[model samples]
Target: MRELRIRAGYETLGELHRASGVTVATLSRIESGVQIPSPKTLNRLAPFLKVSVEDLLAAAGYLPEKEEDPNEAAARTIEAAISDDPELLEFWQELVKRDDLQLLFKQVKPLTPKSIKKIIKVIKAIEDAEATED
Candidate 1:
Protein backbone atom coordinates (compact mmCIF):
# COMPACT_ATOMS: atom_id res chain seq x y z
CA MET A 1 0.00 0.00 0.00
CA ARG A 2 2.78 2.41 0.89
CA GLU A 3 4.54 1.47 -2.36
CA LEU A 4 1.39 2.13 -4.36
CA ARG A 5 0.84 5.47 -2.66
CA ILE A 6 4.41 6.48 -3.32
CA ARG A 7 4.29 5.26 -6.91
CA ALA A 8 1.19 7.39 -7.39
CA GLY A 9 3.41 10.33 -6.38
CA TYR A 10 1.50 11.30 -3.27
CA GLU A 11 4.80 12.92 -2.09
CA THR A 12 3.74 13.30 1.53
CA LEU A 13 0.86 12.83 3.92
CA GLY A 14 0.22 16.55 3.61
CA GLU A 15 -0.49 16.03 -0.08
CA LEU A 16 -3.16 13.50 0.72
CA HIS A 17 -4.54 15.79 3.43
CA ARG A 18 -4.74 18.67 1.00
CA ALA A 19 -6.41 16.63 -1.73
CA SER A 20 -8.66 14.40 0.39
CA GLY A 21 -9.35 16.77 3.28
CA VAL A 22 -8.49 13.85 5.53
CA THR A 23 -6.19 14.66 8.39
CA VAL A 24 -2.64 13.32 8.50
CA ALA A 25 -3.54 10.96 11.34
CA THR A 26 -6.50 9.59 9.43
CA LEU A 27 -4.54 9.12 6.24
CA SER A 28 -1.76 7.42 8.14
CA ARG A 29 -4.20 5.09 9.80
CA ILE A 30 -5.76 4.17 6.49
CA GLU A 31 -2.42 3.62 4.81
CA SER A 32 -1.28 1.43 7.66
CA GLY A 33 -4.64 -0.38 7.63
CA VAL A 34 -4.80 0.12 11.34
CA GLN A 35 -8.17 1.81 10.93
CA ILE A 36 -11.02 1.86 8.51
CA PRO A 37 -12.31 4.91 6.73
CA SER A 38 -15.90 5.79 6.06
CA PRO A 39 -17.20 5.77 2.51
CA LYS A 40 -16.74 9.51 2.15
CA THR A 41 -13.08 9.39 3.11
CA LEU A 42 -12.51 6.36 0.92
CA ASN A 43 -14.10 8.15 -2.01
CA ARG A 44 -11.88 11.18 -1.53
CA LEU A 45 -8.72 9.09 -1.41
CA ALA A 46 -9.64 6.95 -4.41
CA PRO A 47 -8.95 9.48 -7.16
CA PHE A 48 -5.81 10.99 -5.67
CA LEU A 49 -4.23 7.62 -4.84
CA LYS A 50 -5.02 6.26 -8.31
CA VAL A 51 -6.55 3.22 -6.65
CA SER A 52 -10.01 1.82 -6.14
CA VAL A 53 -11.40 1.25 -2.66
CA GLU A 54 -12.11 -2.34 -3.62
CA ASP A 55 -8.52 -2.80 -4.70
CA LEU A 56 -7.28 -1.26 -1.50
CA LEU A 57 -9.53 -3.50 0.52
CA ALA A 58 -8.42 -6.49 -1.48
CA ALA A 59 -4.82 -5.58 -0.79
CA ALA A 60 -5.62 -5.49 2.88
CA GLY A 61 -7.34 -8.85 2.49
CA TYR A 62 -10.53 -7.35 3.80
CA LEU A 63 -12.55 -8.17 0.72
CA PRO A 64 -12.91 -11.22 -1.50
CA GLU A 65 -13.96 -11.76 -5.07
CA LYS A 66 -17.22 -13.49 -5.82
CA GLU A 67 -17.85 -15.68 -8.85
CA GLU A 68 -20.32 -14.29 -11.36
CA ASP A 69 -21.73 -14.99 -14.80
CA PRO A 70 -20.56 -13.03 -17.87
CA ASN A 71 -23.58 -10.71 -18.03
CA GLU A 72 -23.50 -10.25 -14.29
CA ALA A 73 -19.80 -9.48 -14.55
CA ALA A 74 -20.49 -6.84 -17.22
CA ALA A 75 -23.28 -5.28 -15.17
CA ARG A 76 -21.08 -5.26 -12.09
CA THR A 77 -18.25 -3.75 -14.11
CA ILE A 78 -20.58 -0.95 -15.25
CA GLU A 79 -21.81 -0.40 -11.71
CA ALA A 80 -18.25 -0.46 -10.40
CA ALA A 81 -17.18 2.06 -13.05
CA ILE A 82 -19.82 4.47 -11.73
CA SER A 83 -18.76 3.77 -8.13
CA ASP A 84 -22.21 2.35 -7.52
CA ASP A 85 -23.67 5.80 -6.99
CA PRO A 86 -27.42 5.30 -6.83
CA GLU A 87 -28.24 8.11 -9.24
CA LEU A 88 -25.63 7.03 -11.78
CA LEU A 89 -26.68 3.40 -11.44
CA GLU A 90 -30.28 4.37 -12.07
CA PHE A 91 -29.27 6.49 -15.03
CA TRP A 92 -27.11 3.73 -16.50
CA GLN A 93 -29.80 1.10 -15.93
CA GLU A 94 -32.38 3.37 -17.53
CA LEU A 95 -30.10 4.43 -20.39
CA VAL A 96 -29.29 0.82 -21.26
CA LYS A 97 -32.91 -0.22 -20.94
CA ARG A 98 -34.18 2.65 -23.07
CA ASP A 99 -31.66 1.93 -25.81
CA ASP A 100 -32.03 -1.80 -25.10
CA LEU A 101 -28.25 -2.01 -24.96
CA GLN A 102 -28.23 -4.77 -22.37
CA LEU A 103 -30.06 -7.18 -24.67
CA LEU A 104 -27.85 -6.18 -27.59
CA PHE A 105 -24.66 -6.50 -25.58
CA LYS A 106 -25.71 -9.99 -24.60
CA GLN A 107 -26.65 -11.09 -28.11
CA VAL A 108 -23.58 -9.75 -29.92
CA LYS A 109 -21.72 -12.61 -31.70
CA PRO A 110 -18.18 -13.00 -32.93
CA LEU A 111 -17.26 -10.06 -35.12
CA THR A 112 -16.29 -10.54 -38.78
CA PRO A 113 -15.17 -7.95 -41.31
CA LYS A 114 -18.78 -7.40 -42.41
CA SER A 115 -20.00 -7.05 -38.83
CA ILE A 116 -17.13 -4.73 -37.99
CA LYS A 117 -18.05 -2.51 -40.92
CA LYS A 118 -21.67 -2.48 -39.74
CA ILE A 119 -20.50 -1.45 -36.27
CA ILE A 120 -18.38 1.33 -37.73
CA LYS A 121 -21.38 2.56 -39.72
CA VAL A 122 -23.60 2.53 -36.60
CA ILE A 123 -20.95 4.43 -34.63
CA LYS A 124 -20.61 6.96 -37.45
CA ALA A 125 -24.37 7.47 -37.50
CA ILE A 126 -24.47 8.06 -33.76
CA GLU A 127 -21.56 10.47 -33.98
CA ASP A 128 -23.19 12.34 -36.85
CA ALA A 129 -26.39 12.64 -34.86
CA GLU A 130 -24.52 14.03 -31.86
CA ALA A 131 -22.37 16.32 -34.00
CA THR A 132 -25.49 17.93 -35.44
CA GLU A 133 -26.45 19.25 -31.96
CA ASP A 134 -25.34 22.73 -30.96
Candidate 2:
Protein backbone atom coordinates (compact mmCIF):
# COMPACT_ATOMS: atom_id res chain seq x y z
CA MET A 1 0.00 0.00 0.00
CA ARG A 2 3.00 2.26 0.50
CA GLU A 3 3.68 2.20 -3.21
CA LEU A 4 0.21 3.48 -3.99
CA ARG A 5 0.44 6.23 -1.41
CA ILE A 6 3.89 7.23 -2.58
CA ARG A 7 2.81 7.40 -6.19
CA ALA A 8 -0.18 9.50 -5.27
CA GLY A 9 2.08 11.79 -3.18
CA TYR A 10 -0.33 11.36 -0.28
CA GLU A 11 1.30 10.86 3.08
CA THR A 12 -1.85 11.46 5.08
CA LEU A 13 -5.61 10.97 4.90
CA GLY A 14 -5.98 14.73 4.64
CA GLU A 15 -3.73 14.77 1.59
CA LEU A 16 -5.88 12.14 -0.07
CA HIS A 17 -9.03 14.17 0.65
CA ARG A 18 -7.43 17.39 -0.56
CA ALA A 19 -5.98 15.83 -3.72
CA SER A 20 -9.04 13.76 -4.67
CA GLY A 21 -11.88 15.49 -2.83
CA VAL A 22 -12.83 12.16 -1.21
CA THR A 23 -14.01 12.26 2.37
CA VAL A 24 -11.54 11.02 4.98
CA ALA A 25 -13.86 8.26 6.22
CA THR A 26 -14.40 6.94 2.73
CA LEU A 27 -10.73 7.09 1.77
CA SER A 28 -9.76 5.55 5.07
CA ARG A 29 -12.21 2.69 4.59
CA ILE A 30 -10.97 2.10 1.07
CA GLU A 31 -7.32 2.11 2.13
CA SER A 32 -8.01 -0.15 5.09
CA GLY A 33 -9.94 -2.57 2.84
CA VAL A 34 -13.09 -2.04 4.88
CA GLN A 35 -14.99 -0.84 1.87
CA ILE A 36 -14.89 -1.55 -1.84
CA PRO A 37 -15.71 1.58 -3.75
CA SER A 38 -18.19 1.66 -6.60
CA PRO A 39 -16.92 2.26 -10.15
CA LYS A 40 -17.34 6.02 -9.92
CA THR A 41 -15.65 6.17 -6.55
CA LEU A 42 -12.89 3.96 -7.84
CA ASN A 43 -12.43 6.14 -10.90
CA ARG A 44 -12.02 9.16 -8.67
CA LEU A 45 -9.83 7.25 -6.27
CA ALA A 46 -7.57 5.82 -8.98
CA PRO A 47 -6.16 9.19 -9.99
CA PHE A 48 -5.76 10.04 -6.34
CA LEU A 49 -3.97 6.75 -5.66
CA LYS A 50 -2.04 6.94 -8.94
CA VAL A 51 -3.17 3.41 -9.78
CA SER A 52 -5.70 1.88 -12.11
CA VAL A 53 -9.30 1.38 -10.94
CA GLU A 54 -8.88 -2.37 -11.49
CA ASP A 55 -6.09 -2.27 -8.92
CA LEU A 56 -8.54 -1.15 -6.26
CA LEU A 57 -10.15 -4.59 -5.87
CA ALA A 58 -8.68 -5.38 -2.48
CA ALA A 59 -11.36 -7.94 -1.62
CA ALA A 60 -10.18 -10.03 -4.56
CA GLY A 61 -6.57 -9.60 -3.33
CA TYR A 62 -5.78 -6.74 -5.62
CA LEU A 63 -3.26 -5.52 -3.10
CA PRO A 64 -1.71 -2.11 -3.42
CA GLU A 65 1.96 -3.05 -3.57
CA LYS A 66 4.05 -2.56 -0.45
CA GLU A 67 7.72 -2.66 -1.31
CA GLU A 68 8.82 -2.89 2.34
CA ASP A 69 7.89 -6.57 2.66
CA PRO A 70 10.92 -8.55 1.60
CA ASN A 71 9.36 -11.81 0.39
CA GLU A 72 5.92 -11.62 -1.26
CA ALA A 73 6.00 -7.90 -1.95
CA ALA A 74 9.45 -8.07 -3.51
CA ALA A 75 8.35 -11.01 -5.65
CA ARG A 76 5.41 -9.04 -7.01
CA THR A 77 7.65 -6.07 -7.77
CA ILE A 78 9.98 -8.32 -9.75
CA GLU A 79 7.07 -9.84 -11.67
CA ALA A 80 5.67 -6.42 -12.55
CA ALA A 81 9.13 -5.27 -13.61
CA ILE A 82 9.87 -8.32 -15.75
CA SER A 83 6.55 -7.93 -17.53
CA ASP A 84 7.54 -4.36 -18.43
CA ASP A 85 11.23 -4.88 -19.25
CA PRO A 86 12.53 -5.28 -22.81
CA GLU A 87 16.09 -6.36 -21.95
CA LEU A 88 14.67 -8.90 -19.55
CA LEU A 89 12.85 -10.45 -22.51
CA GLU A 90 16.18 -11.29 -24.14
CA PHE A 91 17.57 -12.61 -20.87
CA TRP A 92 14.46 -14.68 -20.28
CA GLN A 93 14.72 -16.16 -23.77
CA GLU A 94 18.28 -17.30 -23.03
CA LEU A 95 17.33 -18.76 -19.66
CA VAL A 96 14.87 -21.52 -18.86
CA LYS A 97 11.74 -20.58 -16.91
CA ARG A 98 12.08 -20.86 -13.15
CA ASP A 99 10.20 -23.82 -11.66
CA ASP A 100 10.42 -26.09 -8.62
CA LEU A 101 12.77 -28.79 -9.94
CA GLN A 102 14.95 -26.41 -11.96
CA LEU A 103 15.24 -23.63 -9.36
CA LEU A 104 18.60 -24.92 -8.10
CA PHE A 105 19.89 -25.15 -11.68
CA LYS A 106 19.70 -21.38 -11.93
CA GLN A 107 22.09 -21.00 -8.99
CA VAL A 108 24.43 -23.76 -10.16
CA LYS A 109 25.71 -23.78 -13.73
CA PRO A 110 25.88 -27.24 -15.42
CA LEU A 111 29.12 -29.15 -16.05
CA THR A 112 31.06 -29.17 -19.35
CA PRO A 113 30.18 -31.64 -22.15
CA LYS A 114 33.31 -33.73 -21.41
CA SER A 115 32.37 -34.08 -17.73
CA ILE A 116 28.83 -35.05 -18.76
CA LYS A 117 30.16 -37.87 -20.95
CA LYS A 118 32.07 -39.36 -17.99
CA ILE A 119 28.95 -39.10 -15.81
CA ILE A 120 26.83 -40.72 -18.57
CA LYS A 121 29.38 -43.57 -18.91
CA VAL A 122 29.05 -44.37 -15.19
CA ILE A 123 25.26 -44.41 -15.54
CA LYS A 124 25.50 -46.78 -18.57
CA ALA A 125 27.81 -49.20 -16.69
CA ILE A 126 25.48 -49.21 -13.69
CA GLU A 127 22.47 -49.90 -15.97
CA ASP A 128 24.30 -52.61 -17.97
CA ALA A 129 25.38 -54.50 -14.83
CA GLU A 130 21.89 -54.24 -13.35
CA ALA A 131 20.36 -55.62 -16.60
CA THR A 132 22.82 -58.57 -16.80
CA GLU A 133 22.58 -59.65 -13.11
CA ASP A 134 19.05 -58.61 -12.24
Candidate 3:
Protein backbone atom coordinates (compact mmCIF):
# COMPACT_ATOMS: atom_id res chain seq x y z
CA MET A 1 0.00 0.00 0.00
CA ARG A 2 2.84 2.38 0.78
CA GLU A 3 4.47 1.49 -2.52
CA LEU A 4 1.24 2.05 -4.41
CA ARG A 5 0.63 5.41 -2.75
CA ILE A 6 4.14 6.56 -3.57
CA ARG A 7 3.90 5.32 -7.14
CA ALA A 8 0.67 7.21 -7.48
CA GLY A 9 2.71 10.39 -6.81
CA TYR A 10 1.63 11.01 -3.24
CA GLU A 11 5.01 11.64 -1.60
CA THR A 12 3.45 12.30 1.80
CA LEU A 13 0.33 11.26 3.66
CA GLY A 14 -0.65 14.93 3.64
CA GLU A 15 -0.50 15.01 -0.12
CA LEU A 16 -2.75 11.97 -0.34
CA HIS A 17 -5.08 13.44 2.21
CA ARG A 18 -5.49 16.58 0.12
CA ALA A 19 -6.22 14.62 -3.05
CA SER A 20 -8.32 11.73 -1.66
CA GLY A 21 -10.05 13.45 1.25
CA VAL A 22 -8.84 10.61 3.49
CA THR A 23 -7.24 11.93 6.66
CA VAL A 24 -3.48 11.81 7.05
CA ALA A 25 -3.81 9.96 10.35
CA THR A 26 -5.81 7.17 8.75
CA LEU A 27 -3.35 6.98 5.88
CA SER A 28 -0.45 6.88 8.30
CA ARG A 29 -1.98 4.08 10.34
CA ILE A 30 -2.75 2.00 7.26
CA GLU A 31 0.70 2.50 5.79
CA SER A 32 2.46 1.72 9.05
CA GLY A 33 0.68 -1.64 9.29
CA VAL A 34 -1.10 -0.54 12.46
CA GLN A 35 -4.54 -0.57 10.86
CA ILE A 36 -6.38 -2.13 7.95
CA PRO A 37 -8.60 0.13 5.91
CA SER A 38 -12.32 -0.56 5.81
CA PRO A 39 -14.04 -1.17 2.49
CA LYS A 40 -15.36 2.40 2.47
CA THR A 41 -11.87 3.76 2.97
CA LEU A 42 -10.55 1.56 0.19
CA ASN A 43 -13.31 2.80 -2.10
CA ARG A 44 -12.43 6.40 -1.31
CA LEU A 45 -8.74 5.85 -2.03
CA ALA A 46 -8.79 3.41 -4.94
CA PRO A 47 -9.73 5.92 -7.66
CA PHE A 48 -6.97 8.33 -6.76
CA LEU A 49 -4.46 5.45 -6.71
CA LYS A 50 -5.76 4.11 -10.04
CA VAL A 51 -6.41 0.66 -8.54
CA SER A 52 -9.47 -1.44 -7.96
CA VAL A 53 -11.12 -1.72 -4.53
CA GLU A 54 -11.02 -5.51 -4.90
CA ASP A 55 -7.24 -5.43 -5.27
CA LEU A 56 -6.96 -3.39 -2.09
CA LEU A 57 -9.38 -5.70 -0.28
CA ALA A 58 -7.38 -8.74 -1.33
CA ALA A 59 -4.12 -7.15 -0.25
CA ALA A 60 -5.64 -6.19 3.09
CA GLY A 61 -6.67 -9.86 3.60
CA TYR A 62 -10.37 -9.09 3.44
CA LEU A 63 -10.64 -11.28 0.33
CA PRO A 64 -8.77 -14.44 -0.61
CA GLU A 65 -6.43 -13.91 -3.53
CA LYS A 66 -7.57 -15.67 -6.68
CA GLU A 67 -7.98 -15.17 -10.37
CA GLU A 68 -10.81 -12.78 -11.17
CA ASP A 69 -13.22 -13.30 -14.02
CA PRO A 70 -12.36 -11.06 -16.97
CA ASN A 71 -15.91 -9.98 -17.66
CA GLU A 72 -16.59 -9.18 -14.06
CA ALA A 73 -13.36 -7.27 -13.78
CA ALA A 74 -14.16 -5.28 -16.89
CA ALA A 75 -17.57 -4.41 -15.54
CA ARG A 76 -15.99 -3.09 -12.38
CA THR A 77 -13.50 -1.08 -14.42
CA ILE A 78 -16.26 0.49 -16.52
CA GLU A 79 -18.38 1.18 -13.48
CA ALA A 80 -15.50 2.94 -11.80
CA ALA A 81 -14.73 5.00 -14.88
CA ILE A 82 -18.30 6.20 -15.16
CA SER A 83 -19.02 6.60 -11.47
CA ASP A 84 -18.57 10.38 -11.53
CA ASP A 85 -20.76 10.89 -14.57
CA PRO A 86 -24.49 10.23 -14.32
CA GLU A 87 -25.00 10.17 -18.11
CA LEU A 88 -22.19 7.68 -18.60
CA LEU A 89 -23.50 5.55 -15.78
CA GLU A 90 -26.90 5.40 -17.39
CA PHE A 91 -25.34 4.40 -20.72
CA TRP A 92 -23.23 1.75 -19.05
CA GLN A 93 -26.26 0.37 -17.26
CA GLU A 94 -28.04 0.10 -20.58
CA LEU A 95 -25.03 -1.46 -22.31
CA VAL A 96 -24.66 -4.23 -19.74
CA LYS A 97 -28.30 -5.19 -20.14
CA ARG A 98 -27.74 -6.28 -23.72
CA ASP A 99 -26.74 -9.92 -24.10
CA ASP A 100 -25.09 -9.31 -27.47
CA LEU A 101 -22.48 -6.99 -25.92
CA GLN A 102 -21.53 -9.18 -22.97
CA LEU A 103 -18.32 -10.26 -24.71
CA LEU A 104 -17.34 -6.61 -25.23
CA PHE A 105 -16.95 -6.19 -21.50
CA LYS A 106 -14.41 -9.05 -21.38
CA GLN A 107 -12.42 -7.42 -24.16
CA VAL A 108 -12.40 -4.06 -22.36
CA LYS A 109 -10.69 -5.23 -19.17
CA PRO A 110 -7.20 -4.41 -20.48
CA LEU A 111 -8.05 -1.13 -22.18
CA THR A 112 -6.66 2.23 -21.13
CA PRO A 113 -8.99 4.94 -19.79
CA LYS A 114 -8.90 6.86 -23.08
CA SER A 115 -9.86 3.73 -24.99
CA ILE A 116 -12.64 2.97 -22.56
CA LYS A 117 -14.07 6.44 -23.01
CA LYS A 118 -13.95 6.00 -26.77
CA ILE A 119 -15.81 2.71 -26.51
CA ILE A 120 -18.46 4.31 -24.35
CA LYS A 121 -18.83 7.15 -26.82
CA VAL A 122 -19.27 4.66 -29.64
CA ILE A 123 -21.88 2.82 -27.64
CA LYS A 124 -23.72 6.06 -27.02
CA ALA A 125 -23.64 6.91 -30.70
CA ILE A 126 -25.02 3.52 -31.64
CA GLU A 127 -27.80 3.88 -29.14
CA ASP A 128 -28.65 7.32 -30.43
CA ALA A 129 -28.70 6.09 -34.01
CA GLU A 130 -31.04 3.25 -33.08
CA ALA A 131 -33.33 5.65 -31.29
CA THR A 132 -33.44 7.92 -34.31
CA GLU A 133 -34.32 4.98 -36.57
CA ASP A 134 -37.19 3.98 -34.33
Candidate 4:
Protein backbone atom coordinates (compact mmCIF):
# COMPACT_ATOMS: atom_id res chain seq x y z
CA MET A 1 0.00 0.00 0.00
CA ARG A 2 2.81 2.37 0.81
CA GLU A 3 4.56 1.52 -2.43
CA LEU A 4 1.32 2.15 -4.29
CA ARG A 5 0.88 5.48 -2.48
CA ILE A 6 4.41 6.54 -3.33
CA ARG A 7 4.10 5.37 -6.91
CA ALA A 8 0.94 7.43 -7.22
CA GLY A 9 3.02 10.45 -6.01
CA TYR A 10 1.68 10.62 -2.49
CA GLU A 11 5.05 11.23 -0.74
CA THR A 12 3.68 11.10 2.76
CA LEU A 13 0.71 10.00 4.85
CA GLY A 14 -0.31 13.66 5.20
CA GLU A 15 -0.54 13.98 1.42
CA LEU A 16 -2.63 10.82 1.20
CA HIS A 17 -4.83 12.02 4.05
CA ARG A 18 -5.43 15.32 2.25
CA ALA A 19 -6.44 13.54 -0.93
CA SER A 20 -8.21 10.42 0.46
CA GLY A 21 -9.80 11.78 3.67
CA VAL A 22 -8.31 8.86 5.62
CA THR A 23 -6.47 10.00 8.69
CA VAL A 24 -2.68 10.13 8.51
CA ALA A 25 -2.31 7.95 11.62
CA THR A 26 -4.45 5.17 10.17
CA LEU A 27 -2.62 5.35 6.84
CA SER A 28 0.68 5.13 8.63
CA ARG A 29 -0.46 2.10 10.61
CA ILE A 30 -1.60 0.32 7.46
CA GLU A 31 1.58 1.10 5.59
CA SER A 32 3.85 0.04 8.44
CA GLY A 33 2.03 -3.32 8.73
CA VAL A 34 0.88 -2.51 12.24
CA GLN A 35 -2.77 -2.77 11.15
CA ILE A 36 -4.64 -4.57 8.45
CA PRO A 37 -6.91 -2.17 6.60
CA SER A 38 -10.58 -3.00 6.74
CA PRO A 39 -12.57 -3.22 3.50
CA LYS A 40 -13.93 0.30 4.05
CA THR A 41 -10.42 1.63 4.62
CA LEU A 42 -9.16 -0.18 1.53
CA ASN A 43 -12.06 1.32 -0.49
CA ARG A 44 -11.06 4.80 0.66
CA LEU A 45 -7.38 4.23 -0.12
CA ALA A 46 -7.73 2.38 -3.42
CA PRO A 47 -9.04 5.34 -5.43
CA PHE A 48 -6.32 7.66 -4.14
CA LEU A 49 -3.70 5.04 -5.04
CA LYS A 50 -5.36 4.43 -8.44
CA VAL A 51 -5.95 0.72 -7.73
CA SER A 52 -9.01 -1.46 -7.22
CA VAL A 53 -10.24 -2.36 -3.74
CA GLU A 54 -9.74 -6.00 -4.67
CA ASP A 55 -6.07 -5.31 -5.38
CA LEU A 56 -5.64 -3.65 -2.00
CA LEU A 57 -7.49 -6.50 -0.31
CA ALA A 58 -5.21 -9.03 -2.00
CA ALA A 59 -2.13 -7.06 -1.03
CA ALA A 60 -3.35 -6.95 2.55
CA GLY A 61 -4.00 -10.74 2.56
CA TYR A 62 -7.77 -10.30 2.80
CA LEU A 63 -8.54 -11.85 -0.62
CA PRO A 64 -6.82 -14.43 -2.77
CA GLU A 65 -4.80 -13.15 -5.73
CA LYS A 66 -6.71 -13.21 -8.96
CA GLU A 67 -5.66 -15.07 -12.09
CA GLU A 68 -7.18 -14.33 -15.50
CA ASP A 69 -8.92 -17.28 -17.16
CA PRO A 70 -7.94 -17.86 -20.80
CA ASN A 71 -11.57 -18.05 -21.96
CA GLU A 72 -12.46 -14.84 -20.15
CA ALA A 73 -9.39 -13.12 -21.59
CA ALA A 74 -10.39 -14.30 -25.05
CA ALA A 75 -13.95 -13.07 -24.50
CA ARG A 76 -12.60 -9.63 -23.56
CA THR A 77 -10.68 -9.55 -26.85
CA ILE A 78 -13.80 -10.57 -28.80
CA GLU A 79 -15.89 -8.01 -26.94
CA ALA A 80 -13.40 -5.35 -27.92
CA ALA A 81 -13.75 -6.39 -31.54
CA ILE A 82 -17.55 -6.35 -31.28
CA SER A 83 -17.53 -2.90 -29.65
CA ASP A 84 -15.34 -1.51 -32.42
CA ASP A 85 -18.01 -2.38 -35.02
CA PRO A 86 -21.51 -1.19 -34.22
CA GLU A 87 -22.92 -3.51 -36.91
CA LEU A 88 -21.31 -6.47 -35.17
CA LEU A 89 -22.48 -5.49 -31.66
CA GLU A 90 -26.09 -6.58 -32.09
CA PHE A 91 -25.31 -9.99 -33.60
CA TRP A 92 -22.22 -10.56 -31.48
CA GLN A 93 -24.13 -9.77 -28.28
CA GLU A 94 -26.64 -12.52 -29.05
CA LEU A 95 -23.97 -15.01 -30.18
CA VAL A 96 -21.82 -14.36 -27.10
CA LYS A 97 -24.72 -15.36 -24.85
CA ARG A 98 -24.63 -18.92 -26.25
CA ASP A 99 -22.48 -21.28 -24.13
CA ASP A 100 -22.01 -23.68 -27.05
CA LEU A 101 -20.28 -20.96 -29.11
CA GLN A 102 -17.89 -19.85 -26.33
CA LEU A 103 -14.97 -22.07 -27.42
CA LEU A 104 -15.42 -20.99 -31.02
CA PHE A 105 -15.37 -17.32 -29.99
CA LYS A 106 -12.19 -17.92 -28.00
CA GLN A 107 -10.52 -19.58 -30.96
CA VAL A 108 -11.46 -16.66 -33.22
CA LYS A 109 -10.05 -13.90 -30.99
CA PRO A 110 -7.41 -13.00 -33.58
CA LEU A 111 -9.80 -12.98 -36.58
CA THR A 112 -9.83 -10.23 -39.18
CA PRO A 113 -13.04 -8.34 -40.07
CA LYS A 114 -13.46 -10.44 -43.24
CA SER A 115 -12.84 -13.64 -41.32
CA ILE A 116 -15.38 -12.55 -38.69
CA LYS A 117 -18.02 -12.13 -41.38
CA LYS A 118 -17.17 -15.56 -42.79
CA ILE A 119 -17.45 -17.10 -39.32
CA ILE A 120 -20.81 -15.40 -38.83
CA LYS A 121 -22.07 -16.89 -42.09
CA VAL A 122 -20.81 -20.36 -41.10
CA ILE A 123 -22.55 -20.04 -37.72
CA LYS A 124 -25.80 -19.03 -39.43
CA ALA A 125 -25.50 -21.98 -41.81
CA ILE A 126 -24.93 -24.37 -38.91
CA GLU A 127 -27.93 -22.96 -37.06
CA ASP A 128 -30.09 -23.39 -40.13
CA ALA A 129 -28.96 -27.01 -40.54
CA GLU A 130 -29.69 -27.75 -36.88
CA ALA A 131 -33.16 -26.20 -37.18
CA THR A 132 -33.92 -28.41 -40.22
CA GLU A 133 -32.65 -31.49 -38.34
CA ASP A 134 -35.05 -30.66 -35.45
User: Could you tell me the TM-score of candidate 3?
Assistant: 0.49
Give TM per candidate.
Answer: 0.41, 0.41, 0.49, 0.50
Candidate 4 backbone collisions, by pair: none
- Per-residue lDDT tens digits for candidate 3, residues 17-112, read 999999999999999999999999999999988898888889888998778787777888888877777898898987888999987665544777
lDDT, candidates in the order shown? 0.66, 0.59, 0.86, 0.79
Per-residue lDDT of 1-134 in model 4, one digit per residue for the tens? 77899999999999999999999999889888899989999998889899999888998889998988877776665566556666566666677789897677556547775565666656767876998999
Q: What is the lDDT of candidate 2?
A: 0.59
Best by lDDT: 3
The reply for model 1, stretches above 4 Å from the true place, is 60-62, 65-134
Which ranges of candidate 4 are over 4 A from the true structure?
A: 68-134
Clash totals, every prediction: 0, 0, 0, 0
Q: Give the lowest summed-lDDT range of ten residues in model 3.
A: 104-113
Scored against the true structure, residue 57 in model 3 reaches a CA lDDT of: 86
What is candidate 2's lDDT per residue for 29-125, written digit by digit as tens? 8768787666677778777777776666542355554445343333333334455445543443333344652443334344554543454355456
Model 3 residue runs over 4 Å out of place are 1-66
- Tell me which of candidates 1 and 3 scores higher on lDDT: 3
- Our model 1 lands, by Cα RMSD against the true structure, at 9.9
Give lDDT: candidate 2, residue 34: 86
Worst 10 residues of 1 by lDDT: 112-121
- Sorted on lDDT, best first, the list reads 3, 4, 1, 2
